[model samples]
Target: MSGLLALLDDVAAIAKVAAASVDDIAAAAAKAGAKAAGVVIDDAAVTPKYVHGFEADRELPIIWRISLGSLKNKLIILLPGLLALDYFAPWVITPLLMLGGAYLCFEGAEKVVHAFAPHADHEIEEDFDTKDPAHLEEEKVAGAIKTDFILSAEIMTIALDTIDSPNFWMQAITLAVVGIFITVAVYGAVALIVKMDDVGLHIAATGRTSGGRALGRGLVLAMPKLMAFLSIVGTAAMLWVGGSIVLHGLEDTHLWAWPYETIKHIAETTAYAMPVAQGFVKWLVAAAIDGVFGLILGVLLIPVATRVIGPLWATMTGKKAGPDGHPG
Candidate 1:
């Protein structure tokens, strides 16, 4: 009986330790996920366009497909790569992060250029849209997934950087949790955003009461505007997050210091100017500066990316296999 009690006590102790670890991971994931909020928002915002013109019936399915792809991106490709980086060459992460930030800046700047360009829709986007419906759906899903991979890389890296785990297993588990949480949050919100008009329509058509119908009508009217708003916010967020990442990376790598220190000084000065709302004011100023920096970098990159990088990529990849090259 005594021996059995001792074994039971040992098991219980192990269980307690396991439970504590789980709790710790959960807490860490949440904190780390918060650190990647800008990327997360951008991911959600960028996704809806993928299913924009699809039939209502196809929207959710397309989102599900992309969600699965995002899952694969985070779990299969990025997670392992991140783990390997942390274990073997931890120093590389900052540079890779800065590279991602540059890409984000480039993307954000391109969108800004496209917004003002004579052609409202880019040539590539137009080509994708003109394809047959089935093909279009496939292409859009593939494009979304590929895009998700980049944003996901940023999110995971940010999350990893924020975590203060003591060892490998804890970091891995925290990252896995963060990946799953962010994916579900991002894609789930996207699914809802894309389908909201249909839901509103259904409600308008079938509501039992006048109030319900009015609300449905309001939703129907509001969705397009909401999507437009999300797009603008998403772009702004991408620039801000990207710029912030690059600044931090440059500072961390000892390549650049003036911008970081300057931004910090400005934020602090602004905080002093408005001590009542110092925290909020400082953050706002800092983010705005970061965004401006990102816009400049992005603008600079636009020519380089289009003139040099695009051709180089096309040459390396052979005929520019479209978005993983799965028939569409």
Candidate 2:
């Protein structure tokens, strides 16, 4: 009896420890995931375009395929690569982060330029017109997965940076949780966003009440505006998060301190001026400054990327460059 009770106590203690570890992993994953919110939003916003012309039934499947690809990217490729880097070359993380941030800035700035100037994507249009539906679907899915890989790399790296644990297993488990959760969240949202109109139509066609039908019609009417709004918000978030990352990287590397310091000083000054909502005011001021800086940096990078690097990359990779000078 005594031996059995001791074993039972040991088992209970191990279970308690396991439960605590699970809680820690959850908490860490949430924190790390939160750090990648801008990327997450951008992922969700960008994914629906891949399913735009597909049949309603195909939308969810395409999203599921992309989600699986995204999961593989995060888990099979990026997670291992990042862990290796963290173990062997931890110092490289900041520079890579800054590079990713710059990419985000470039992407956001390109969108802003497109929004203002409204250039036609003749190549994309021609491809869509010439390609058969099956081929196009494959191409779109492949392209989306490729794009997701880049964004996923950024997300995972950001998460790794946010994780404070020195234990390898803790870091690994946290990253795994972050990767799986984010993949599901992003692609799940994408599926819903794309299918919302169909749902609206179905409701409009079959609703039992006038109010329900009206709600369905409202949803159908609202989807385009909602997409536009998400795009704008995603672009803004990208710039904000990217600029903040770059600024922090610079500060960390002791390369330049003025940009971050200046933003902090201004934010603090504003916060002092308005004590009622000091934290909110401070954060708003800082984010605004970072976004402006991101915009400027991105604009400057546009010419360099398009004219010089884009051509060189195209030549090296034998891939066609898009209007934004990225390989299509």
Candidate 3:
């Protein structure tokens, strides 16, 4: 009887430990996910574009395919690769993260430039003109997956950097949790965003009540504006996050310290001026500074990307170079 009682106590203790571990993992996953918010938001915002012209029935399927691809990119590819890096070549992580940050800056800058100048995307037009719907779908999905791979790599790296666990299994489990949660959250939001119009139309057409119908119509009318808002938000997020990453990386590498320190000093000064909302004011100031820095860096990178790296990539891929040095 005493032995049985001891065994019961032992089991209870184990259960408690397991529960604590689960809680730790959940907290870590949430923190890591939050750290990758910029990439995640951009992922959600960008995904719907791939399904834009597809039949309503096809939209969900396309999103599902892309979601699956994103999951594979994060879990199967990035997770393991990052783990290996953390274990063996940990020093490389910061530089790689900075590279990802630079890419984000370039992408955000490109969007800003495109928005202002609005050049024709002849390649996209050509694809639509040449390909059948099924083939086009395949190509879009492929392109989306390729883009997702880059974003997922950044997400996983950011998550890995955020995780504080020393245990290999804990880190692995937390990363997996972060990846799965993000993939589900992003694609789930995308699914809803893409189908909102249909849902609104259905409600508008079929609702028995006037209020329901009005709500439906409102949703239908709101989707385009919502998408536009999301794009703007995503672009801003990319720049802010990218600039913050680069600044932090520079500090870590001891390559430069003034930019980050200056921002911190200014943020603190602003926060002190608004003691009632110090935290919020500090964060806002810091983000604004980072964003402005990101915009400038991105603008600088655009010419380098278009003129040099684009042509080099075109050459390596054996694709004909466009006038802008991108693959034609």
Identify the leading candidate in terms of TM-score.
2
- Candidate number of the best lDDT: 2
lDDT score for residue 33 of model 2: 97
Per-residue lDDT of model 2, residues 223-282, tens digit only? 999999999988998899889999999998999988889899999999999959999999
Flag regions of model 3 displaced more than 4 Å: 127-130, 321-328
| TM-score list, all predictions | 0.93, 0.97, 0.96
Which runs of model 2 end up more than 4 angstroms from their true locations? 127-130
Ten-residue segment with the worst summed lDDT in candidate 1? 319-328
Candidate 3 lDDT at 119 equals 75
RMSD, model 2, all Cα superposed? 1.3
Task: Report how far off residue 92 is in candidate 3 (Å).
Answer: 0.6
Give per-residue CA lDDT, model 3, range 196-266, as digits (tens).
99999999999999999999999999999999999999999889989999999999899998899999999
How much lDDT does candidate 1 score? 0.88
TM-score, candidate number 3: 0.96
TM-score of 2: 0.97
- Assess each prediction's global lDDT (C-alpha) against the native: 0.88, 0.91, 0.90
Candidate 2 vs candidate 3: the lDDT winner is 2
